[model samples]
Target: MSQYKPENPATEEEEPDTLLMQLRRKEGSWLDWAQACQTLLQRQKMTPQVIFEATGFEPIHQNQIVVGSQVYEGMAKAGASPAVLEYFGRKGSDILYELRILSPKDRVQVAELILNRNLNADDAHEIARAVKNYAQLRERPEGFGDHPGDAVAYQAWKTAQQTSDLQERTRAIGRAFQYVHSDGARQQIERLLSTVAASSSGGSQRKILPKLSVFRLEEDLPRLLPVVGSLPLSTAAWEQQITPEPEGPYHLIHSQGQQTWVALPAWSVIQSARDPVAIPIENRLLGTLLNQQIPPEEAQDPVLLVVDRAVRQWQSEGFFLIDRAGSLEVEWREDSGSVSLFGRVLMAVRPPRILDEVVAQDPWQLDE
Candidate 1:
C-alpha cells in the first residue's frame, strides 16, 4: 500500500476575506468598505435604510460606491452589525436558505431582534420556518421586535395575524376565545367587539356578521348575538354529507350511445423555455428534414408513435422515466415554482452537461 499523503486544496482565485482585509489595511476608507457591505446586505434583501442606520456611512460622495465580489464576505467578516452578520450568515449558508417563507420585513425584524439580543439565532429560525401564506402572517406586530418574547408565543401570534380584512376579523374572534384563559380576557373581548362595531356601518353589518359566523366560537355565540345579530347553526352536521370525493385516474360524465363526456387526469404543464426537449417538433422538423435526418413522409408517424407509447407507459407505471436511482416526472408537478421541491422527495437525475450549463449561467435563475 502507498503511504497516504494529506490532501491540500489550492486556494480560490478570489478569497473575499483576504481581499477585504487587504482593502481595510491599504485603503483606510471606512465609507468605501461600508458601501461594499451595504451592497451585500441589499442582495440579501436587507433595506438600504436599515444598513445606513446600522452603519453611519455618510452618503456625501457620489463616486464612492463601486461594485466588487467580496462586499458580502467583507461585510460578514467585519462584523458591521450582529443583525446584519446573522442575516448574511443565514443567507450565505445552504442550510438556512430554507427559510424562504420569511418576508424581507420578517428578516429585518429578526436582524433587529438579534441586535437587541432579544432573540437568539435559533429563535429567529423558528420564526422563519412558518409557511408563507396569503395572510402576511410572518409580519411582527408594532411592539413585537421591541421586546424579546417567547418564541412560541411570537410564532402563535404571527400565525393568528391575517392579511385579509375579513380573515382578520375572523381571527379576532378566535383570539377572543383564546383570551378567555388569560387574565385580561374580558377586556380583550370587549376591545375586539368594539373595534369590529366601529368598523361596521349600516349595509356592511350584514356582510360582516355572515363572515364572522364562518369561524364558530360556540361558547362565545351567546355573548356575540347582540353584536352579530343571530348566529347561524354551525355547518358541521351537513359537512359530513359533502365530504370531499377522491380524485381517480379518470372520470366519466356521460355514457349514452354515441355522445360521451370523459375527463382524463389533469396532467401538469411545465413551462420550460430553456428545455430543448420542450421545443415543438414541427419547428425542429424543418431543419432536420433539410439536413436529411429522416424522410419527410416517415418523420411524423414514428415521432408521434414514440411519444404516444412513452406517455402510455409513463401513465401506467406512474413514471415518465426510471433508472437505477429512481423515477423522474412521476410525482412532481411541473407547474411548481419551487426549486427545492424536487430535492425534497426524490433525487432528480439530470444530464451532467445540462446541470453544468445550469450552474454556469445566472445562478438566481435556477431558483426561479
Candidate 2:
C-alpha cells in the first residue's frame, strides 16, 4: 500500500486550498457587487460639487507643488484635471482617495470584476431589450475590464450564441475527483475527520475545542460561521432600486444613539464589528449566513470580547472574513477599498485577524 494518501480524496496533488482560497477571495467582493455598480453609475450623474458633497472634499485650484517626480508640494500642478493634488495651495483632504479611485488600475479592477464575474451577457448584452434597459444605467469611462471576448464564461457563451449546442464546455468543467483535489487537502481532511471523531466522544471531548464535525455532524454542533441578514429585497429578476443612503465611515457601533455617522477610521469600523457582543447586532448579516451553514439556535457563542480601541483596517485597503468551525476559526481574504459612503452597510463574512485578536485572553472572565 502507498504511504501517502491523496491531498484531497478527489484529486492527488498538493492540496486544493489555494484554489478554494482564490474562489473565496473572488466571492468576497460579491456581496458588494451591487454597490460597486451603484458607485460607477452615480459617478456620471453626480457633478463635481455632488462628488465633493458626497465624499466631503472641496476642489482646489491651480499652481501645485513638485518636490520630486513622485512628490508634489507647494502649489498645485497645471490644468483643470478632474482631480487636483491640492486645492488653491491647500492640500485637500480625501483627495488621496479620489486619486486612487480615478486611477486606471481602479477602473480595470472594476471592469474585470463586473463584466467577468458580475454581469451576464444578456444582463450585459444577453437580451437585446435587456441591454437597452441596462444601457439606461450609466457606465463611466473609468470602467475597464470586460471586452467582447475577455471573460471565459463570455467566451463560451458567445460560442454558444453562434453554435448549435454547448454540451461540451459545461461537460469539461465537470472533471471532478479525477482532476481536482490535491494531496495536502486530503491529509487536512483526514486530520479534521479524526479530530471530529475524537471530539464526538461526548463529555470526553475537550471544551477548548468544542465538538468537531465529520461532514454533517459538524454542521449540527453549531460553530460554523453564520451569515445573518441579507440585503436583497427580492429573490426575483432584473429590477434596480436604491434605498438606505450612505453614512460616515464610522465604527459600526452596535450601541444605540451611536448610530449616527462619525469620522472614524476603517480600522475602527472593522474592529467594532469583531466584537462578539456585536454578533447580536451583526446577526442580521453573519447570523443569516451562519444559519445556512450551521443551525441558528444550536450554534455556540464565540465568547470573544472584541477590542474596540486597538482595532484597525489594514492600511485602509482591505476587508476580512471569519470562518467558524465551532471552536476552530478560519480567516478569509477580501479586497474592500476604503470609502464609507453614508447609508451603505459594510458587509463582513470572516475576519479571523480581527476575531483572533478579540478572542485572545479568555473572554469568559470568571463570572464577575
lDDT of 2 at 128: 27
Cα lDDT tens digits, model 1, 55-117, are: 453332111232211333344333457656545433322212323344444444444444454
RMSD of each: 26.8, 34.3
Q: Model 1 misses residue 142 by how many Å?
A: 17
Which residue pairs show collisions in model 1? Answer: none
Provide the clashing-pair count of each candidate structure: 0, 57
Pick out the ten consecutive residues of candidate 1 with the lowest summed lDDT: 222-231
After superposing candidate 2 on the true structure, give the runs of residues whose Cα lies further than 4 Å from its correct spot: 1-284, 287-292, 299-308, 315-333, 340-368
Task: Give all candidates' CA lDDT scores.
Answer: 0.33, 0.28
Best candidate, TM-score: 1
Candidate 1 overall lDDT versus native: 0.33
